[model samples]
Target: MNREAFYKLTYGLYLVSSLRGEKKNGFVSNAVFQVTSNPPQIAVVCNKDNFTSQLIKDSKLFSISVLKKDANPKLFGLFGFKTGATVDKFESVKHITAKTGAPIVVEESLAWFDCELINTFDVGTHNIFVGQIIDSDLLDSESEPFLYSYYRDVKKGKAPKNAPTFIANK
Candidate 1:
């Protein structure tokens, strides 16, 4: 199969956050989607090795902040490129803890979602978690929500090694 053709599959960039004990962790992700609407469900794919993934497993909750066009690329680089085990991802970032006590990103967010994990499917290198929406709100109206295509074509963003889109031969 031509995996690059999967590039046709669109995604929106987001700051996905969760907590374990007193430790909060977040990372950049584009693999999020709505699995259902009646009960309002979403599926988020995360690498099993990610610290944020570990936090999600422990906390059983997560927050997704949809990134805006004006959002700082540095924030994305920090969350997407740098590993939280080596550095504090939230040190320089401004955030607010939600009703779920999950941190939500305020910088350049178009919308946000706080979810409670309901199910999990182990998929080798990645784990797919399905959750029910606990909290959700829109942030911006005038500006557009930045698309993954824009991140690549406009910002020249490169897919990280752990990203689902990472291609072995490019």
Candidate 2:
């Protein structure tokens, strides 16, 4: 089986965040997608080992911040490469607490969605968190969404080990 075939699947870059009490955490993800339209629902796939995953489970809330094409490279370094347990990822970033109490990253984001976790599914190394969209807003009307293809092909970015699309070196 050619793993490279998976790369053909389109994905968008996003920051998935959740708050457990006063502590909030976020990570860069490409596995977020809309699950339904009528009632408005979305799903985010997070590695079971991710700190943000547990936070989302415990809080029953999450926020998705859609990244723009011109998003800062440092945002990926801080949120994607570093662990939130050891680093304060939101310390210097501009963000706001959503109605669901999840942190919405405003910096370098084109849109934001506040969601209430409705269901969860265990999928081996990752957990799929399905949420009902509680509230959402568009921040930049003119900016184009950041795509995973652009991240890989243009920016030459690599997916973290925990990412669903991560391909280990053979």
Candidate 3:
């Protein structure tokens, strides 16, 4: 089985955030996708060890901030490479609390979605959280979405170990 085949699957980059009481956390994810259209449902996959995953489980809410093609590289370093356990990822970033109290990253975002947790599925190392779209808005009408391919092929970015698409170097 060639793991490289998985790389051919298209994915978009996003920031998935959630708030638990006073604590807020988020992470860079490429596993967010629409699961249904009739009831407007989407699913986001998070690693079990991720701080943001616990926040999402506790809050029963989350927000997806769609990154633009020209999104700042530092955003990835702050949210993707650094752990929210010791770092306040939102502290230095420009963001707003959604109606669901989840943080929506405004900087370099092309669109945003506030969601309410509807169901959860345990998938080994990751948990897939399916949510109903509560509210959403477009931030930039002209900007193109940031794709995972671009992140790798152009930006030469690497996925964190916790990411669902992460490939170990052998």
Best by lDDT: 2
Scored by Cα lDDT, where does model 2 land? 0.94
Rank by lDDT (best first): 2, 3, 1
lDDT of 3 by residue, 1-170 (tens): 99999989999999999988888789999999999998999999999999998899888999999999969999999999998999988889999989988889999999999999999999999999999999999999998999999999988999989998888981
Model 3 scores a TM of: 0.98
Q: Give the worst 10-residue stretch by lDDT in candidate 1.
A: 161-170
Q: Which is better, 1 or 2, measured by lDDT? A: 2
Please, what are the lDDT tens digits per residue for candidate 2 over residues 40-151? Answer: 9999999998889889988899999999996999999999999888888889999998998899999999999999999999999999999999999999999999999999
Judged by lDDT against the true structure, how good is candidate 1? 0.87
Residue 45 CA displacement from its true place in model 3, Å: 0.8
Off by over 4 Å in 1: none
Looking at model 2, the pairs that clash are none
Please report how far candidate 1 places residue 25 from its true position, in Å: 1.0
Q: Backbone clashes in each candidate structure, one number apiece? A: 0, 0, 0
lDDT of 1 by residue, 1-170 (tens): 77768878888998999987777789889999999998999889999888899889988999999898857889878999998878888888888888788999878898899999999999999999898998899888878887998888787788878888887754
- Candidate 3, residue 111: the lDDT equals 95
